[model samples]
Target: MRYHFLSLVQIFLLTVTTPVWAAEQIVLNYKVFRESLSVEEISRFAQTGELSSSLKINFALARQNPKAVRQYLTQPVKVNPVFLDRVLNTPLGNVILDQISQVIHTPSQKADRQALRAALVLSARQDSQITLIEIFKNYPTSEVEVDGDRLESAYRQLRRLQTNIENLMGV
Candidate 1:
């Protein structure tokens, strides 16, 4: 049964490594349309505020203001990784993650909460701050699907989370 044992080992390796794929493309989903862009392109725009033709077209079609989008992309929320992890493990944190997951998720729409929590913690651990772009950069998927129509709501949700944390910490 050597052949059977080898097959089982291969299957185990693939299953264990499946979720390690980092996001390469982001798909913005609007009610009537969608557009895909590379993570590099978005990062460049966020850093330099320079729009590639594809981004220009996407923004124009989506009727989004480049400056506002840039601001949202780069806004940083300071966090303590240990505290963040503790908070995220709570029931309230799970509820927040569930709400945010509806706006940002993997292409298959599976493990959304787990992925988002991983991304957030990873981003915060890397730096003391988390940004929208940082979260997307750390997402554990080949493709990230974002609800373009609900971006503002997601931002508000994040802000509320920050406010709640601040209040709890008396900061």
Candidate 2:
């Protein structure tokens, strides 16, 4: 009877431990890309330097916009224009930045460089709106403080960036 009780305790322990182990695996999967690198490699290439310049910029933008990230992650991956706009605008747009940074390198092949730059610009523009919406959602009171002149200037800059990206992508 004691042996039977001990076996039950062991089974209970294993069941409790199993989820912790599974969670660790999930975390590992998320961080695996970093693990493959040697310390020397990381040191030689500054984290930002390791990524393409465009990707670095995109990361900055994404860091600034978290809502987009949440929306993108939660949404289905269909190509709905409205959904696309939201995803692009949210911090989730940072995914494009992440992809570009992962692949971008100095002395990159010409084809790769061109493709990355085009993607960076497009993602930034589309995502910017989502980010702005998120900001508004979070801080509705800030709308009352809007300076018309500043708002116009910001909008112009955003439009210019979007146009430049479209031109580069020929889209």
lDDT of 1 at 2: 50
lDDT of 2 at 43: 24
The model with the greatest lDDT is 1
TM-score, one value per model = 0.85, 0.21
TM-score of model 2 relative to the true fold? 0.21
Query: 94-170 in candidate 2: lDDT tens per residue?
Result: 44423332333122223433333333333333343422122222221211111211322333333444444454445
Among residues 3 or more apart in sequence or in different chains, the pairs in candidate 1 whose N, CA or C atoms overlap within 3 Å are: none
Q: Which ten residues in a row have the lowest lDDT in candidate 2?
A: 21-30
For model 2, the stretches where C-alpha displacement exceeds 4 angstroms are 1-131, 135-148
Model 1, global lDDT: 0.84
Model 1: per-residue lDDT, tens digit, 19-131?
47678999989878998989999999999999999989888988989998888778887877777788888998899899999998999888998999888888888777788
Query: On a 0 to 1 TM-score scale, where does candidate 1 land against the true structure?
Result: 0.85
As a whole number from 0 to 100, the lDDT of residue 123 in candidate 1 is: 80
Q: What would you estimate as the lDDT of candidate 2?
A: 0.31
Misplaced by over 4 Å in model 1 are 1-19
